[model samples]
Every structure is written in C-alpha cells, then in structure tokens.
Target chain A: MEFSSKVLEKAVNEISQLPGIGKRTALRLVLHLLKQPKEQTVFLSQALLTMREEIKFCLNCHNLSDVTICEICSNKNRDHKIICVVEDVRDVMAIENTGQYRGVYHVLGGKISPIDGVGPNQLNINSLVKKVKSGAVSEVIFALSSTMEGDTTNFYIYKQIQESSIITSTIARGIAVGDELEYADEVTLGRSILQRIPFENAFKNY
Target chain B: MEFSSKVLEKAVNEISQLPGIGKRTALRLVLHLLKQPKEQTVFLSQALLTMREEIKFCLNCHNLSDVTICEICSNKNRDHKIICVVEDVRDVMAIENTGQYRGVYHVLGGKISPIDGVGPNQLNINSLVKKVKSGAVSEVIFALSSTMEGDTTNFYIYKQIQESSIITSTIARGIAVGDELEYADEVTLGRSILQRIPFENAFKNY
Candidate 1:
C-alpha cells in the first residue's frame, strides 16, 4: 500500500513480518494503533523490548523463564523424576494449563525437521540427556506433535536415553475429547482404538 | 494462561489488546518472537517507537503523513477541483490501487456513528467544509462504504454543502464485476437495475 507517512509504512512492514499477518492486516493494526492514544504504542514497544531483553530460558528445563531456573523445575512439590518433553514453551504452557501433570518439563525448543535445517544438536537434547544421565529423572514422557518430525524427535531422544533403565513413553494420540468419532481422521481413530485403555482408567476424571 | 516470565505475560497482555488477537494467539506470537533471533524483536520495537514518535497527520487532509501536506494533495497531476471523500486512508490506498482515479482525497477520519459515540464534530468535517467554502472544489463525490454509518455521514456532509452550487454525487452501488445475477441480493440487484447506466458507459474500461 502507498502510505503517505514513511514511519507508518515502516511500522506496517515490521508488523507484517510476523507469522500469519499479511500487509492488509498489518495496515489494519497500525491504523487501529493510530486511532488510539499515542501512549498505547509506547506501552506496546516498551513491553516488547522489556520481554526481549529480560526473558531467559530455564537453565535446567530450557523453558522460557524470568530467572535462571523456572518455577515448575524449582518447585519441590512437583515431581522432578518425571520429565515431560515438549517441542516449545507454548507446548509447556498448554500442558501446564491441563493441571493434570505434576512433572517438570524439558523443552526441546523444536522438532527434528531436516527440511527446516533444525537438527538434534540445535535443540536442548543434550541438556535433557544430561538431566536423565544424572540418574535423577525416572521417566521421560514425549509430548511432541503427531507429525513425522515429532515422531522422529521422540525416537531420537528415546535412543539417546535407551541405555539407561529410565522408562520412556510418548503422549497418547487420539481424537480430541470433545470431538465426534465420525469426523476423526482414520489414522488417529485407528490408533485411538489400538491404544484404548480400560473403561475405568479412561473416565477417571468423571 | 500461566506464564513463567513476567515480561512475556506483559507482552502478551499488550498484544492481546489488539482487535481479533486473543491470549492464545498472543502467546503464540510472543513465543515465535522468542524463538527467532533477538534482533527481530529489536527491529520490531524500534520500528513501532520510531513510527509513533515521528508520524504526523497532514494538516489539510487529516490523513497520516510525515509532513503538513500529503503527497497526493500536492501532486499537480491529480484534479484539485474534484475531491473524493473517503472514511480513512485505507480507502484512499484502495482507490489508488485501481489506478483509475485522478482526483485528490478528503479523509473523513471516521464515519459518524452515534452508537459508537462518534459524532460529526468529532470527525474532520469542519476542515472539509472550510475547503468546500473556499469555492475551488467543483464536485464532491462520496465514496464511503454502503453501511448505515457511511450513508449517514455522507448525507450529513451533503446537507452541509447543499447550500453551495457545487455538484454532489455518490459512488454507485451495484453487483460486483464478477458477480452472478442469479445469486445477487435483492436490494443491490434492484438498485443496480434502477440506476443502470448506458451499456457503453458500463463497459468503458473494457
């Protein structure tokens, strides 16, 4: 778009660089910002800068934290022996929201995607191995996506820790709890059937 | 959602305040930024701040600009006598993209919507009237949206300028270029048929 203000154009360009946001969306956002008080922009900019500068990854779990070690990893009430492996901080957040798991997380940062040039070395696999090799972690649960990359990363991590006696498992794959079985994809439906637990164990929450 | 980092929470809060962005989406955006090199955040922050600090509105048109007068209004190639009244700068950009118009623009800033607490006085109507009263403009075309608010604003402006001898017109409302007449809405189809232009005028661009 032909923006009369160079600054507006620059701001739109910067905003559009984000994933899923296009030039039209960026323009809408910038125009919305312009409509509001100038202080909103100041606050937004400050918040982003502050987050960028101060945010740190947990030294132990590799999850995003404000300090050297995250609260989940540092809390004694949580089970440190069970390490739930996730692809990113967002996954950690998602699992945390369930309020089901008591285990601390090991954030791999991303899956093993060869096409994207992301290898095992690029992720926090070594740190996780170090944690497991310390003999403190009893079980390592793989909670990555169901995609091929996710399975590859899970297998890669499982192989690295297979020598140890620590029990390794992956999160269950199935149709979502609220979804209709008829609409479920064939692969997931088949897997869900094969991995079906006893009726009592499945409805423990109820 | 529970956040390990305070800065991340704050950034998410600010981002989620924008229209259509929810907390989950905001978290996704924040995490994406975290995954990328820190320089991207710096660039985004710098662009927002620079734009907010340096941006100015054109004094004459009330459109966002770097200077007192916008480039469009100052361009000698555009017809200064014919002004296309629009709701905002995006509309101006949309019309400009067609590469058909040669007239300058008068940005109303926003449509008059009592429901949203926007009144005629709150907009740039006074400046538009001042421009019209100067007696240079020969035609004032209302190119606002077909919404009630847009129509009200156009009518209000039309009434304000009715005392003057200058001709006033509104852009046509009709079936879109590629629309099928069978599926067209009654209101628009009826209006298109009632205000049907000569066959030659309809295909002038062809």
Candidate 2:
C-alpha cells in the first residue's frame, strides 16, 4: 500500500533528519506547512536558500557572515586585542548578547572529538594560532564549553599561546560542568566572563 | 549595536513568527540552517516554495492537493455514497492511513466557534448540504472532534441535513475530550470508525 505521497515522504524524511524531530513530528510539521499561507512557506524556503547562498564563514573569526570579515571583526569599537575562542557561532551570539565583553571572537567550528574522528587540524585552530603569533593580540580568552573535549582544546590552545609570550585566560568554572555555553543565560555568561582566571597554572595537576 | 545582519535579522523575524518559536529559538534555527550543507538548505527552501506554488485546496473535499480534484476524490474505488465530514486535511490523512474506510471526505475548513467568530455559514456546510441533496449519498458521517465547538458545528450541520431523506451518523464517543482526530492512533481511530452510531438519538440528553 502507498502510505504517503512522494513529495510528502521526501519532506518528512528531511524533517526527520533534524536533531529531535521524529517521524510523527515530521508528519505534523509537513501537515502544518501544507495548511500555511503560500507566501509564508515561500519565505521559509527563501530564507533557508539565502542562508546558504549569501552567508559564509568570516575569514578573520570564522563566524557566519555575508562578508569576508564578520561585523564583530570589522567594527572599530570592538577591542581587537582581546579575542574570545568559542566552539560555534551560537556561542559567539550568546557572548555578544551579554554586552559585557567588547572582545571579538574566533569560532573553532567544532571541538576535538577523537570519538567523532574530529582533530585539531579539522578545526580553524591554525588560523587562531597564526592570529596569536602575530604579536598584535594581548589576551586570548577561552570561552569554549566546560566539557571534557572542551577542556582538552582549551589546554591545547593555552599551551600554544603561552609559548608566544601572549597572556592566556579561561572563563571561570562558575558555569556548571556539562553545560553548553550556548544555552547559558546572558547574566551567567557575563559573570563567567568577568571572573576569568589566568591560565599560567592551567592543567598543573594534569 | 546591530545584533545581527540585516538579512539575518529579517530571517530571524520571519522564523520567530512561526508558532511555538521564540526569538532565541529562531536564532538557534538560523544557526542550524547555517551549519547545514548549502544543498540541504536550498532543497528545504525549494520544497517550501513548491508547496505554496503547487498545492491548492481540492474543490471536492477542500483538502490540500496538487490538483483541483484530490487523489481520494478522483479514486474510482472509494464509496461515493458514504461521505465523512471532517474539520481539516490532516484528519483526512489520518482516516486514509487506516485503510478501512473507503468513503469520500468533505473538509469543513474549521469548526463553529462563536468566540472566534466562526459561524456555520463561514464553513463549507452549504456545499455539504448541496452534495447530500444530490441524492447519490446514503450516509453522512461526522468525524469532527468532541470539542464544544465541534459538537456545535456537528449539530448545526445535522439540522441542515435533517430536511433531506439521507441517513446521517457520527463516529463513536470513545475518543477523549479535547483530543484531535489527527493525533489519534490508527487502531483507536479504526475502532471508532467501525463502531460509528447513527445520528438519530445518538446523544441521550441533547
């Protein structure tokens, strides 16, 4: 028996590919889309298409941007000397919304997960190291998550920057373990940034 | 300070307009779109656009379809003499998935909600009356939800169809209060369809 239409089947399959959407949820979304005004659906499609066609990785910070340099990197008022390293663009937006930090950001694209076959070479770590080695940078703040992999990347970057005579710091542990930086509220993120500690004795036990 | 790019701002606003999606969720969805491959985003966008441009209300049943007459309406094997009236297209799909009912369907667009200003005339009730008066229909089934408004609309349609000689019936009351027909599992829905009671004196008190 033909259970569903071809287009609907394809659409449902695609929706099911999303993080938490299951087959039933995918069906609900497709049915909802079918009922929506044609213009609304068109807008959704156009936004997604433009998101791919127009947006690109910022050459300087690796944040999503329409231009080579993201708005944060190009802004003159932002403190270029202080760079906050984060795992993704969502983390950068979370930090930006705090309004406490005037520093720019560098998105590592992803954390080093050996289980997932991700390594330092796969991330934008080389560009970050080059940026720090230029000697123009004053302080490098680690805004990566407090996960095990996050700590490993943080220590790796800390060791890389310490050899270049640049000051290195990591956001305070006030952020509870296993919590994502992207989901952290603005006030908590701001407090965490304000309570940053020097990384000279970082990983002293390890 | 500009929080996001102009296009991104517009896109985020558009995404936030969707039901259950807030500003932060909209931002997350946008970031997820950015992470997806260009082709994936483009395909989703095109699908949305195509859904709007290609799909239309089936003239016979008011269900969404790519053609004037829907697949069910055009099917030669479906029982034309037995018509099931429902609130929306999703209900039609649910009933169809059961593979038990071979009857055609008539979508009422919405239930009678005095609070929401939806009246009997606002729905496709007049056309339903016209279809019944044409004399080919033997039985008319009310598969609307058990909500207050659904009950009101079902009674209203019943009143309109009582003048005709055609038989009328309603799906069983085993479906719980405030439950949507679309979300009901196939087995329960199939049981309800099989145990449908005749419209005359089905409600004891009313």
Worst 10 residues of 1 chain A by lDDT: A197-206
Candidate 1 regions exceeding 4 Å error are: A203-206, B203-206
Can you tell me the CAPRI class of model 1? Answer: medium
- Structural similarity to truth (TM-score) of each candidate: 0.95, 0.79
Interface RMS for model 1: 1.0
TM-score of 2: 0.79
> Deviation in angstroms for A79 in model 2?
2.2
Best-performing candidate as measured by TM-score: 1
| Model 1: per-residue Cα lDDT over A1-206, one tens digit each | 78878898999999999999999998899888888998999999999989989999889998889999899989999988999999988888889888899989999999999999999999999989998999998999989997899999989988889999999988888899899999999999999999999988986861
i-RMSD values for every candidate model: 1.0, 3.1
Error of 2 at B141 (Å): 1.0
TM-score of chain B of each: 0.97, 0.81
- Cα distance off (Å), candidate 2, residue A93: 2.2
Candidate that scores best on lDDT: 1
**Candidate 2: fraction of native contacts reproduced:** 0.31
